[model samples]
Target chain A: MTGMVAAFTATILAAGSTTLLLAVASLVVATILGMGAAFAKLSGNRLLRTIASAYTFVVRGIPDLVVMLLIYYSLPALLNQWIDAMGIDARVEFPPIVAGIATLGLIFGAYMTETFKTALQNIPKGQIEAAIAYGLTRRRMFVCIILPQLIRLALPGFTNNWLVLAKATALVSLIGLQDVMFRAKGAAEATGMPFTFYLIAAGFYLFVTVFSLILLALLARRFEIGLRELAP
Target chain B: MNWDVIAENLPLYAEGAKLTLLLAVVSLALSFVLAVPLAFLRNGRVPAVRYAVLGYTLVFRGTPLLVQLFLVYFGLAQFELIRASVFWPWLSSPMVCVLLTFVLNTTAYSTEIFAGGLRHIPVGEIEAARAYGMSRRAQAFRILIPGMLTRSLPLYGNEMIMMLHATALASTVTLLETTGVARRITLNYYIQFEPYVTAAAIYLTLTFVLVSGFQLIQRRWAGYLESRIG
Candidate 1:
């Protein structure tokens, strides 16, 4: 029992931080891609709309596990071959973090696109029109008129996507990323207490998820300040 | 771009597609059966049991299904008690392990979906059923179950497609479902995108069919539910 406890502690020490790092990095990357996709979907150009829609449809249909494996194992070989043909003797290999982040970012990007698009549509059109008629620059209009409401409206769906994405970082282990899940597996093998170690990993994940929900709720409250009942 | 490569491996892909369907359909059926009773038990007057089931659903929802699968497949075997039990032999099989994980995971998600549908059941309907001199069992059989299933069909359909996506995780447990076969074909052929892309195409077609089927259900039933609730 003591051995299992010590092994779990060591496993958490070794890989827990990496797991958090992966989730945060991928979440940022995914949010950017999602914003881009959302804009492309809403843009006037037919080709952009078609491309964005197709990207989302493709991503949503396939599982993230397949996408992650493809990016990790196959993409490097494909890239390296091209690099070799360019008179470079060097090979290209993505570190597990890079591959995990990029694959997860791509997968979650589809979900966030829908969240963003729905949020954008819910903004009262009179508000955007008023901002435009007041002669604000595009940047100014976005910052001053649109951004605040967007954040408020997007928070609920964003919270859901963020929770799901954070849990997904666990899958990075399958691609040889030494995240908490990976370390826990090693601990299970070494200590012969697979349940003990796996339980520890699940605890860490549940903690991250619960913590995120609390933080998101606070953020939603902050963004929802004016519209809520402050009956004082 | 390599149509020839996919054409050569069509049989392998077809085999994979079959397993994927089997895994998803069987598990989903079991989840539906498990979820209906759990949905009722979820709100049963016993706070202790209710909280226990809620905890079960919460754990499943709060963590990744991959971890849950690993916990069952690899973690449980470490226990001497499990190894000595009759259940050990059942859990020893990979396909059984995968099916159990999917069934448990889908049951949790579907329980929430069905519970939501149950919440939408108007009180007056239950009273009407009671006033009509119907027994509790008859009321449940004649009205509540049908009403809940009908109302939750759209959400349940989404859950079913999610289950389809989840069959990809079976590959991690060594089941050669669609995504698993794709990985093999990719590594063997030294082509990354071709096999995975083909798998994605198959998955997309399945999802399209699922969505259309649900849309038909929604059109038939949404008007009925909206009038009852709205």
Candidate 2:
């Protein structure tokens, strides 16, 4: 009995680590996609703006699970068709983990685009004008002026997105990613203690949430050091 | 690509959509009913009562809804006592379990949203009611609740849409909601794209309808508040 309990504990912990890795990797992908889309939407070009708008609209409209399932089951087939059309003899493999991350990244990218666009817009226009007046290049101006304020402005929304994304990692288990949820389901079946195993799974998620909340709070305070609110 | 498969499955999709709507609407209605009183408790004077409500919201909001669903659906049946209990019949049904989980999950979030709305009510408004010699019950029912609910409309609309999307999770437990129907179609046909894409489209339409409906409601109900600002 002790041996069986130990095995379950070990497997769940290992699976929890995988969940964390998936969430972080997807967050990175989402941040990059979101940043590009935000810039595209904010650009002067009408076509870019329209395309970006459509991307966010469509992606945000559908549920994340459906999107994940659609991508997981379809992408490989679609890729194979393209490969066949090209007369390539090689087959590309698409793993469930990759599908999970990509779909999550794509779906959350829409949300992050909105968050980033708002953050970018909230940057005082005069600061950019002043940076140009001071002869700073666009790159330097963004790094020195926009990035800091963007971090400050976007952190709250970013934290919210991160937390949601972390919880969303559980959905990847449905696509056979063998994350904590999958492990818990297995343990529950094996031990006939579904309540105990599922409770532990919830504990794993709650731990991540509470830990992230504390860390993000510290980060927020760090970024907010020089900031002061205007009197209401 | 398989137009034939999609066309043949249209009725199944419609039936699934109906179930999806039922799940979303019932759970949202139930959550609203539960959340109103809990929101009031959250805002009430006692620290213990407030903290109790906060803890419920924190746990529900912190964990994934999938976990909560599993805890109720699969986990609850693990106990011999529950299985032997009078409620086992209702608890054994996937539909009941899903609805119960969704209501609990949504009620937690809605309570917080409504509580925030309550806190945001201008203190002066409450004071004015008091100064007018309104009874406590009158002040609560006539003034406070309406003001909080109106202020909560936009956020609550968001929660409604979220609840709608969340019905997709019901598929995991063998409920034939929209996503479940899509999954079944895929299993039968061995074609992935058509059924899932159809599901996505259905969800998109529902989301659009909900958004427009909320906009109309917001225009009529919350219009005055925006007008004051402008």
Indicate the worst ten consecutive residues by lDDT in candidate 2 chain A. A223-232
B119 Cα displacement, candidate 1 (Å)? 2.4
**Candidate 2 structure quality by residue, lDDT tens digits, B1-230:** 67799898899999999999999999999999999999999999999999999999999999999999999999999899999999999999999999999999999989999999999899999999999999999999998898889899988997898899999999999999999999999899888777888899999999999999999999998787788788
Clashes of each: 0, 0
DockQ of each: 0.67, 0.85
Per-prediction TM-score to the true structure, in the order listed: 0.91, 0.96
Pairs of colliding residues, candidate 1: none
- Total colliding residue pairs, candidate 2: 0
True contacts kept of 2: 0.86
Off by over 4 Å in 2: A82-93, A229-232
**lDDT (Cα, 0-100) at B173 in candidate 2:** 98
Candidate topping lDDT: 2
